[model samples]
Target chain A: MPNTFAVPDYFVSPTLLTRARTIAQEHASLAKRLATDYDVSAARRLGELQSTSTAVREYDEAHSALEELQSLLTSTDQELRELAEEDIQPTRDRIEQASAALKSSLVPVHPFAHLPCLVEIRPGAGGDEAAIFAGDLVRMYKGYCARVGLRSTQLKYDTADEPTHVQEAVLEVDSPGSYGMLRCEAGVHRVQRVPATESKGRTHTSAASVLVLPSIPTEGGGDMGEASFDDPKSDYYVDPKEVKLEVMRAGGAGGQHVNKTESAVRLTHLPTNIVVAMQDSRSQLANREKAWQLLRSRIAQLRREEREEEIAKLRRGAGAGKVGRENKVRTYNWGQQRVSDHRSGLDVRNLDNVMEGGEALERIMQSVRTWMAEQEVLSLVAEEENSQAQKK
Target chain B: MPRLAPSLLRQARAIDVLLPPLLPACRDLRSAENELRWLKDHAIKTGRQCGLAHSDASLKRLVARRARGEPIQYILGTEYFGDLELKCQPGVLIPRQETAASVTHLAQQLSKKRKGRPSDLHILDLCSGSGCIPLLFHHEFYAQPGNEHCKLHMVGADISVQALELARRNQKSQIAAQSKRVTAQTTSLAAMRFLHADVLLSEAANAIHAPIGVVEALQQLTNTRPTPAYEVLISNPPYISSQAFRTTTARSVRNFEPKLALVPDNPSSAPSALDGDVFYPRLLALADQLRTEIILFEVADIDQAQRVATLLARQSTWRTVEIWRDEPGATSDEADHVLLDGGESVPVRGAGNGRSVFAYRGAAAAWLQ
Candidate 1:
């Protein structure tokens, strides 16, 4: 609803672009300072300054070339304009590539950017239909994952009391660095449709809340990537003393009552009051491990948001509709047979196709990615502003 | 993705035996080319037996056998399951892709269970034709870096002495041809004990046609006076209907595979499913006696799964009975759903088309009587 899917040139914050010149200037001064001092502190400062300087130079070179080529497009001379037109595509590509490299160097890395992701979806409001729509959301994401070549493992899926419909589900995207791409998918999604079970053909509004968290690397088991879960400095690390563990019989659907023993493990983080229940595993130990993982990820995400609060303005009003957590980010309306992503304001008319994660879904995801990158640029811009203010 | 080479295509054309189509079925052109490399290796190794070393003849013979409905694994001598290559021979059933999938699913479940547990574990493989299940588990358990010290004492019980012998050889060969993935671990292969006992009879030795002195045989293999309590019981027990085997089963399987491995030998008084699901009830009873935590069985299909679920429900010994799909990574939601108390329906959560049933004892919640 914010409709912030600006053009590529304007998407990056102006402050970051201006800060490139400043970073270049600082690097020059730092190099001189290092040469004069030749101390450990100056040498370390130089080490950090070196990459920043290179990235700034790279961004400036591409940005300037793009600006020059763009100006030539309006040249009076016909031959020059034709030359500009011919070179425009290549020059734009170079700028985009350089900016990507520059952005990676400039922006502070999200602590969990390289970790895998877990997506938990639950019905928020709208009763039985909401649960049914939640199931649909699960299918949509699963389809999207398939199209994107991201492997999703169903960690837990609970059907509604009706037995035929799904109520809540958790799917783990196992691909490394999936968290960076999927993190912004958290928040609320709204749907408006006539309930199939309704006899009166009344349109009912429903919502599903999606929470995306970074999955901890399974200690010593599971997939290849080995990530630390015990290091205090690591974002994913959780203090065992702060957690309260409980094991009970795994409940809900088919997994229930199958184990004559108590196999389900639930972890409550005393500090955060965050509760995570895991019973999919038959062994209590397995359940405990999974529950601990879920708890760690939740706490880590909360920690990230606490840090993100300082630059929360970078994400200001990205979602327009004030329906649920951080505004309803997307709406799927069956009456209009359309899916509208609020941040990008991308309206794809084919609801079925969007739900299937077809071309329509791809278009929305790509635009959202662009918007997220712009937000990162804005955050970098804010960081530069803070440092500049301090210096002044 | 390489296209089939023109020369290879020409060579396939020249060869009279029907190996061309079979090669591509294994993989794309690259797979066919790889098989060609294996054929060449076989050819260069021996020239005496049936002129195997005379390159072209060896390829022709290999193809001819496959073309005549012999399983490619049998002819190839090894089937790769997980990271291990199980030696396949006649009489013993070849390790199927479905079987490999079942092993993978079971191992993942067990790996989670093995967290901070005892290093030494015992497993029983009923109707373990090729000893693939235990051997595959042996490899999977030691696959991780820190679990190198984990030891698995595996028992493979089958009535056929031929199958038992092949199973033993598979155990030796799999241990010898250690997978590079598991070389990070120094754990030896599971200590194997091949039991020549029929599960149907009261006495283990009496179950078999020939008296192999069951207790003596088991002792000789295990070197343990009394068998330890098995933690896991796994089987790919035969569940095919007589009619399906006679009519619906694949021509190659019907023609070549041992009938003893595919069908219940004497089925007139068979206990369940009206066809031959006698093994399901027997295995459940056996599981009750063993008090095994996990029981995994490969079924014929969803229909057989339904029949087995009914048996588990009737037996009322276990807490949860789940139908698992055999295809890797496929969601349990896509698999068949079984109705529980209060008319709740839930899919057996795991990968594949739900061709297997994974039942473990949960807090003894009573099933519908």
Candidate 2:
């Protein structure tokens, strides 16, 4: 059954073709009965025919068209041959497009697609360069958000020990559906650039990781279509008992005021170990509130990822192993001025423009979206084949 | 300093005497633990240069002082105020979170005009200790893109020469360290500098208005007042009354930080409750003298802020005298005549509990609307 619905590769599954043929034949008889007897029951049966088996009707129409075209190909006249040659391609394309559209529609929409997102960027390997690159990525996102009419706010910006680079940053892109748009950006982003600290001209590899999570309200992931973190009823709500809160003076820096004032709050979810430390606010309460909001989003993201993994494992067996396939997504090479997205396997030049978050960045994101759609369609087709095979 | 090495965290954990255990509250223990981690990191970094023994002795002294309630900022000799990492010294009071918040709010309102600022934006910070307010504002303003062309002419004015020297040192280090981080490369020709001037004196106030004693402040001071009718006037002036400072203020602050930066000067032998508010009228007079439009002051608390607003109401200089707060009030805009700016938008700096007073005219005057 898994290989049965490999459409056209094996002339559609015999079982599926037979099913469609049976439906078509049944529909023909019901139509004929309704025309002759003129009974309401017969008419109703005929009316529901297309709805019951869409594939059968489409196959019926295309089969008949192909039969007529096959006959035309055998005609002696040159004009008839030419006409068949021209008409055959478009008809086939129409059927393919229609079938794909139908197959894709069968798959449910991603649950978190409509929700806004928070993107957490952190340094991975390369020391100062990695931190600088992380900061660069933050700027790029903020610029891109500005260009796209999305309000991007920095919730937390942890300065590095080096002081020049940001150690960590959380940006909330406050537009609905940004999660779907930015989720593809999750994974490690590699940068190849000659360090300013480097004396000799040589390229060094550095990496920054982007973790995109749906911006759930800290209180509740409400059914009201609005997420609030304060709502105990919210799916995002972390039980107070489950979280350990820690308050410290703002990092050892920021003068005596930052040192004496215990303003920084860190929230550690016991089960998940997802810790969100916030010290930007001078007040402990404010910091705690921010930490909760971040923790909720992160935990919600973690759960969503787990769910995706489950779906991925199913899709891999049922269709293709695209889910849980890859993580290293993109690379920014400064010397060559190239940005290559591994997901789409697209190598785009103008690294600076991409860093500026211009059209090149959009193009790369669009390619990721297109690639995602194809994977989704493939998985949906596979799932349909599995279900249909089991019925057989 | 060195990303708080594991050894440092372990070291802080081992100590029970100097590093007190934080309460379960998320705000308490983390900072103390964090500072120890940084101190260890700094110690390691210093050790790299001067050997372990040299680092050990100095670190021991710093740690011992911290145990005795000396601020870690003074020990580390550095502070991150907003976007800028300013140099900290003993005489100059460290920049408060309340000041950082008030300055942030001020910068946002001023930068709303963005690129097409009529001319250069002139800001004057009175009682500017460590020059943290103006220094941070300069750095934060330029940190964002599209602010490359924003000519932010800044002046940090203080009465204490020590503060002025410390402010200059902060200015120098900030430029040295954060020059690459921000857009304003060298901070224009004479944009960022410190000046010595007492706001309490009309003689010093006249120094800015007429061509009188401002020359002396200029001959002596590197920074001066700019021409375009000072649009923004900000201060974290001393507002703590003697009674409140004695009771409410922390022992760490009382023992270490300068008193000049926290409380007002006594005009008479016996200081009254009104003595704390002496700067509000002087600042009001200075604002009136210079035609300063937007004004923000960091008061001790909401009650003191309310009194400042009342004092502001007496004068016709300001059209709106609003108190921006973080706490949830009964209403959005209050009957108390203080406008509530920045509702849930930008986080307010006060004590994280609404306490700063803002008096203004011109575009920024209409905060709530």
Top TM-score hit: 2
Docking class of 1: incorrect
lDDT tens per residue, model 2, A167-193: 899998878889888887888899999
* lDDT score, candidate 2, position B273: 56
lDDT of 1 by residue, A219-299 (tens): 733442334666676667788888876544212211100111234567899988999887664334566777877788778
User: Worst 10-residue stretch by lDDT in candidate 1 chain A?
Assistant: A252-261
Misplaced by over 4 Å in model 1 are A1-14, A26-105, A220-227, A249-262, A310-325, B1-369
Interface RMSD of 1: 18.6
Query: TM-score for all predictions?
Result: 0.47, 0.50
DockQ-based CAPRI category assigned to the predicted complex of candidate 2 = incorrect
Clashes in predicted model 2: 18
Q: Score the docking of each candidate (DockQ).
A: 0.02, 0.05
Model 2 alpha-carbon drift over 4 Å, by segment = A1-259, A263-275, A278-392, B1-29, B53-58, B113-117, B143-147, B178-190, B204-228, B269-271, B326-351, B362-369
